[model samples]
Target: MVTRRDLIRWLAAVPLFASIWPLLRLDDARAAQTPRRVRPGEPGWPTPSDWARLKQQVDGYLIRPESPLELCRESPDNAECLALFRELKNPYFIGDSPVLTQTCEWVGAWRAEPSAYVVAARRVEHVAAAVNFARERNLRVVVRGGGHSYLGTSNAPGSLMIWTRAMNEIRNHDAFVPSGCDGVIPPGPAVSVGAGAIWMHTYEAVTGGVGRYVQGGGCGTVGVAGLIQGGGFGTHSKQFGIASASLLEAEVVTADGAVRVVNARREPDLFWALKGGGGGTFGVVSRLTLRTHELPAVFGLVSCAVVARSDVAYERLLGRFVAFYADSLCNRHWGELATLLPGKRLRIDMSFQGLGKEEVATLWKPFWDWIGLQDDLTMMAAPSIVAGPGRLRWDGTARARFVPGLVVFDDRPGAPDANFFWASNLAEAGHVIHGFDSLWLPAAMLARERQPELVDALMGATRYWLVELHFQKGLAGAPADVIAAGLQTPVNPVVAESFALAIVASEGPPAFDGLTGHEPDVSKAQRDAKLIGLAINELGKVATAGGAYVAESSYFQKDWQAAYWGANYARLLSIKQRYDPHGVFFVRHGVGSEDWSDDGFTRMADSD
Candidate 1:
């Protein structure tokens, strides 16, 4: 019944009415904005009462920064703390705390500090409770097994750390039955170890106590969970298989705080992901069941050092070593640590399982003959063969009494530490030294030598360069189908076809002067590391074009996804998304980690 002019006047006021609606609603919203419930220490941080309640819920103690424990007392220079730090089995706890000067010296090359709290979980329920508490508080959780992550992903700033070293129980089974196996037990001689157990302790328990062995890392301090999850490789890897291949079952705590037993017959997808997918990405592994091997009574050991006079001579010598290593006998473990000092010295160490000294000598006859022809090279000593435990010795130290998986370096207190940057690459059997026409070419120029410009570039950058090679050909000998099947996991696919792993490393002093009050810059450290890494990568490009070893790779790799996981990255990403939809777990250069940047802080990739 209103006039047309009146209707037009009302329409003009419609825009003004709409603008005022939000203000009226905002007034109501203000009344509803109640303060969040907080504890006593800080407005939002957990208080003493909250910590006390959490302690009652778990079997283990919740250690606050102010706790009177030897590791965390009021006095930073407490003598008890120093003593405890030295004997602590877990390396991560040694140097990770910002307040404590005691650090695990093994990882001095790559050290980082974790901000906030550390939870030393004793039982499965403790881990679950910690996870739930972190989720409820909206705090990020970082899992530290042995604290051996090369990229220092195990510890982060402002994260709730779940330290698993206290859960170090190992149970041996003659005929083990995996969980969810429907009453079907696998073969005999298996060991179930707590995820936090160090490899040295496990090795001693199974090998020294039961006369059984498991293929694990050479360094005994490596955590069982970290090694097995990241594709463990040791001196015996070529004889049996990688550490991941020996996994029978595991108990995992997922992001949902559900404790699930994963194996081949149960939770198959998670099982596949846990093996070689890298640790701290899928879930927290509480326990690991692994197949053990019979220990050999005795084995043959060979040790020698060769000196090269010139760069050309060094190249030829290196090529001969590679060629011989490619076709060498099986069940033989050999390592070459080459350095540019004293012109060039290549340390050759080998151990032959289930073989006598005479047989080992015969096996090495080809290499000995090859060494005799070089005029500029000299074998410092005859390749001596002795009968003893097949322990992989580091540097040129005298072989210690075989303790069956005892880590030679880490067990010692106050071991020398160095800051270094390293990169790794895998070379297929056919591609190793293929450009060389003959093994006996003493003065022949090789690919590396042909590019004099590259050599000049390398010499100009650093004082010393080191190349460490480990020959692992077990997977390569397997049928293609078997290799393909194994590659379905998160392990680097290049390992299946690689005849040798080449690790190129460079060492230098700290960039800044500590005495002059010059603080360390994270960006500058990363930049220096990248330059050294690039030089090493360039030197071994042709020899290791297939892929790179994740454990020893450069931290600043540009094509990290392809270099680490190869074709299996997409599947890994899918699995990561399905299990950890909220991105609960993360490791540097790990699967699905491409979305994140490499700053000292842990942040989402999108934020960068």
Candidate 2:
């Protein structure tokens, strides 16, 4: 008789067997000789009757592989499929399905071609049912909120996908307290946001409905749950705090399909883990309650121009901006200063909350004084600038108008056909000049000299290369201990300590040859890879010893664990073991995910 212990010992003898060892029981492995792939519509896959039963168990509908709503590759424009697609309140496609080809374009380089099922979960019950179903069939599961994972962490090939977009619902809860509070509940207005709620929807509902705003993603389509879970930053972050810092409570569905309400007073460890731990790792968050603040009336200014003609001029301007950023860090202010090379331009956008025009002018006087010393520079300010209630709009229809005013630009351009590699570094106040000198300058020179055509192609195609410096001062007034107290989260501690975040990124279009029939052109691919490699290498030098931002980091960073989580990685791993011992939730580059390969195949860690 082969015992479970015996099977474990046997599997332990061979490294290649590690992937399958966790899922197989002694009896099952002994009976089957070897494992086999389970395809859709097979005995292991749920049958029509099984799906029918599942539909009755939840408050949501179930879609089968053969349903009219199933997007077909051969007949993409099938009348039935089109009608069903249009009717779907929220939709996502499975691997090999026609719709998957379009909907799977999150980051072109890492898009998953999954061969499993996709579930558009609308209700909490639907999510629970999906989790139970996946467990029963021994299927790997991936949860997607906005499907915006740049590393393709949201979807796995051959795994079940729980699409949460349909679960979007936003509500305001004024002065509410949790059920199991040991102390006084924090006062003030709070908003309960659904996991699937996009930033724009929540922004509109909270700001317009309650005359309040919460720190959230600048982009309208970014999901609230994913962003907050990953330590979101935006225009209001410097004033309010990172989005996760405002989290009051959360409803999470764990690996066992049990829904748990977590807060400081209940499941405190999980509460800490959920605040800044990378999304789609710990559990599926059903809803989140966040603190909200009244929207402040403010005066703002926007200016941009090609100010530098020589490298000396460029360096001088960069130094001036760096000094300005350091000063802002000491004095609580909201603004961003950026420089785009080749044109050698400087752009400054600032907002002074609750301040009059004269106050705003007085605050910006030093910056204006510095600019006055430069004879060759000219600043162009936008017209029709006004200040008041109507100035702030958060709805979708106003997205186009509001984004430009906020200087919120899309990093991904010509997206579906183009792929980009990006890296982010948190620069301490003292290291700002070192970061620019070591990273941005060298890369800019290299692009102009060695890869002129590549530079031209990128500039013409996607405005490819950029080095951004974002100023945030939310943590300036707080002491190191206070910041450390907040550091119980999985977000990199460097984000709070740093004065600016430097983003170095580059893009390359697909190198497919028409005559070769979708096959990538090797020469073009090699060239693109080389250019991207240079950018990555240069940026790696600028990254502070502290850490990097997870959201805008390179998927291929060598020291990613330290770069993304710093000292918090160990605690996050411990939490993962306690909550998900089976490793039910896994994403590329997530906690405990080092054991998995790029293809979503698991390999047991040496310690395991």
Candidate 3:
């Protein structure tokens, strides 16, 4: 739980803005603006007076109550601040904290308050100003880039958000790679990338033009900052290691508001902490310069979704998926499974980079043969090797029915009742659908039948099908060493890679069926997540008894220093203390406070 005092302390650590005019004096500029229309059931259609009141709360921070507009002149070069001043005066712009209103409903949701979001310069100076202002005023600061966090930590009630959507610029220095680095000649092909740059955007810039590219997220929409900072896992991870391993340098604005560039060469501790330390911890990153490589655009990304006939079928599927992934590892392709769907469908999505379609087929033949899908499956290859930078449009209401133990990497089958509750178990991967016949499948089929373009887009650029294995008390015997090696090992072939498993579902209205049978599922289905905690305690009894414990998906509250920091926990704390001693960056979802004297850290403090 991120306590209020912790947040306050974080704010204190930030470097104050240079003696520019206070941000508060800009209120009078919008004193006479009229509010817009209000509609029923609209998420953001506050009434005129409601808008007025909300705007008042927002302006109260920027204006000195008695006199507004006096602060606008302080920083004449601040385009974002000036643009915000103009946009706020408009009737359409309503100021509401996205945290309370939307974050709880959907993890990836964002409100487009024209004046609410600001993308400061790539340089640290602009970041310092934004951080200092938010800290001085005690405004909760939610940082946004890619908006992919499953926890919805990027937005807060009554908080100001710094949206990094506009920071998508990518600059490549052809002489930064080790091969290109001679004693005098700097290094071979290095790229200084913007935090907001998404995987697809970076891919296009790198591979579309030159043959060179760096490791990025599998999902195109995932941004470089969040994904890399979190120790990104992808198909490429098996060959090149996780994305963070490729990081060379990062220009960041610490909690104290001072900008610092940390790398292996300078500020090594900060550099070490940045790799897999997770985002929103020590500072706000503006730019990340990573190592690059040359690769093909039309390489093979293999996928196999196998259907199971019964519990025994599921066991075979698990064994085959693990064995195949292990075998593929020797060949430089990584393997992973999604366990925890209600039914029994064992599907494997594999990626073989730098290989053509024929090569891809040959590499995946053994796995297909093992699953006995060599004849039953139909392989639909996309026309182009690359896709995206497109828009995101979901049907107004979309729901995900997920099981808790699905993220575990170990090959475990479902206990009698696994899908009944919201028990999140410690596993290696996130939710995996049992069969394509689930709700999401029909939806996809409908989309394919109705919107072929959307279907084409999915097939061409993304892993369209997701198959997960549910790790339960009993499913199969222990995974062999060859399989485990591929499951946990890292590679450094073409791009940096890593794996992440998360349980994502919609917090819908009362009418939605996604949450149906919540209580019954837990009682009847052996679906209590707390049991996992018990199992962790009884680790020896289960595994030594011939079961295996997967390590990828451990669940811990942010305050639980052990769970949050993992192996790198100690270094992360030291970095936090050194960089954010004043505590300006505290209000984020996971970051702890600098001052721990008043109250102990606990999950209860995180609740309303």
Candidate 4:
């Protein structure tokens, strides 16, 4: 698409000596350039003419996104600033903006910053063009879809961002056979979603529109692509399986600007890597197709909280709950989370499929009866159960009547009625994360022989901080077929051997760094981080596994390669070198990320 005049204009933007590139070979010319990624105002940064050319190539979709927080400093009391602060509380409003990440800050680690240029990509060609441009110019490349990374991997300053927010497209296929898999891989029901499509929207199209289910993240606003890459878990994961295991195929743009259709049959190794291999590591995934399953007959939830009057009572309650869970709720019908609180209390927010209200109530009667007999226990909040048609669980309007504030609607004018997030997830919206730690608890911990020690550890952890056990993140008691299928993914093998993942995390509302009166309290953050680590250590006393969920684990995780992927790290690194050898794409904690400097601008020498 470039004319001689355009080529001359681009060449003019370069240093005068670069006009001699015609005399040298392409490979020789490349060797003459520096490998360091450039930032604005730095040497060899893209010129105005170069940027203009890129903008034209992308159909004028490029933009310089700025943070709204800047306006708060400019006019703190103005209507716009006040409105923006209010909108910050809504996840959808935060996601629509390119500069604002869901997480505002991460303790002493990182803060949300605006990139210098954003390619608001609406198609695969746009993404490829942006990637090629960044590679050619030695510019740091950042990609974001949902902008929900707790580690803040999606946003960076003075970089070229391939913002995929505008590419939210969803399509359904009754019998989708991946490219080159016809006659070899049988057709299956599937849904193809653009990189920017969030779970809430995808659920509406695949579950609400059609009577089928797609395993996705429990949080409604989480982006589908990122979750798939991180081994997604949801309320019904006990029955279906992890989200990445359900991926049938993907359309990706590799570092070389090649658009590849990867699946189990075509580019098999790359497809295997895409299954929980980590996003933005191998390439920029343009669209993904995931297998779907038949909808269950019923879906339900159990919400309640209980407190203990004495430490002895708390220990006894823990013992009782552990025994109760193993005996009644250890099967595939149950999922979601339950928290052990610091005040010797327990908060239950569990969900299930195919169980009716009265049925689940009967199953919990023995546990409640045992609690009623205790002299030192008190009921903080009585159990309230909601059971309904499974098809209606994801229907925003239908779920609105289940329990008040259970889900918050996105009431922005002209927004889709299906756009809403779980009220429990509201705290994470534009929040500043203090600390997060998680690890798998092997199924053996639930055995009668180990119940006492497990109870001791559980009670001990509550003393420092709340601990949430997400049963959906582990697939030990799942159906044999489900476990076999889920194990094929690149996630840690321990996920299938464990009964649950114990997570301890904390965060506060948006507090951007260096912003006076609104900056994160470094002392408080460090203190809470220590407590969170201490809480996790208590569980580690019983569970010695290094494996943790990549999406929700510690940012400073020691041996992250082993912790995130276990034995799968080696293979993932091999694939990364094969496809992105020069490292055109980079994100902190992503595979092969250790080969680059912390800022991802400098390539290290110790890479394999």
* Candidate 1 lDDT by residue in tens digits, 220-326: 55679988888767666656666788888999898888999988889888898888888988988999999888786665557688887877777667667655544
Once fitted onto the true fold, the runs of candidate 1 whose alpha carbons sit more than 4 angstroms away are 1-44, 66-111, 183-185, 329-342, 389-464, 477-485, 507-531, 543-546, 595-608
Best prediction by TM-score: 4
> Could you give candidate 3's per-residue lDDT for residues 336-389 as a string of tens digits?
334333345544434344456665666556665555553333323222121111
Considering every candidate listed, which one attains the maximal lDDT?
A: 4
Instruction: Give the least accurate 10-residue stretch of model 2, judged by summed lDDT.
Output: 426-435
Q: lDDT scores for all predictions? A: 0.59, 0.58, 0.42, 0.87
Ranking by lDDT: 4, 1, 2, 3
Candidate 4: tens digits of C-alpha lDDT, residues 1-608:
88544565577567885866465445444544546789899989988999999999999999988777877785567787768767888999989999998898798788888999999999999999999999999889998999999887988888999988888999999999999988998988999999999999998899887889999998999999999987778878889998988999999999999999999978999999888988888899999999999998898888788899889988998888888888888789999888998889988888888778899999888888777788888888987788888788788887778667778988799988888998889898989889999989998888999999999889878889999999888998899988998889998998888889999998887777876546777788889999998999898899887678888888888899999899999999999989998889998878988878888998766342
- State the lDDT at 205 in candidate 2: 81
lDDT of 3 at 394: 9
Clashing pairs in 1: 94-103, 95-103, 95-104, 595-605
Q: Which pairs of residues clash in candidate 4, taking residues 3 or more apart in a chain or in different chains?
A: none
- For candidate 1, the per-residue lDDT at 427 reads 16
Q: Tell me the alpha-carbon RMSD of every candidate.
A: 10.7, 9.7, 17.4, 6.7
Judged by whole-model lDDT over C-alpha atoms, candidate 2 comes out at 0.58
Q: What is the lDDT of candidate 1?
A: 0.59
Question: Which is better, 1 or 4, measured by lDDT?
Answer: 4
- After superposition on all CA atoms, how large is the RMSD of candidate 3? 17.4
TM-scores, all candidates, are 0.73, 0.74, 0.54, 0.94
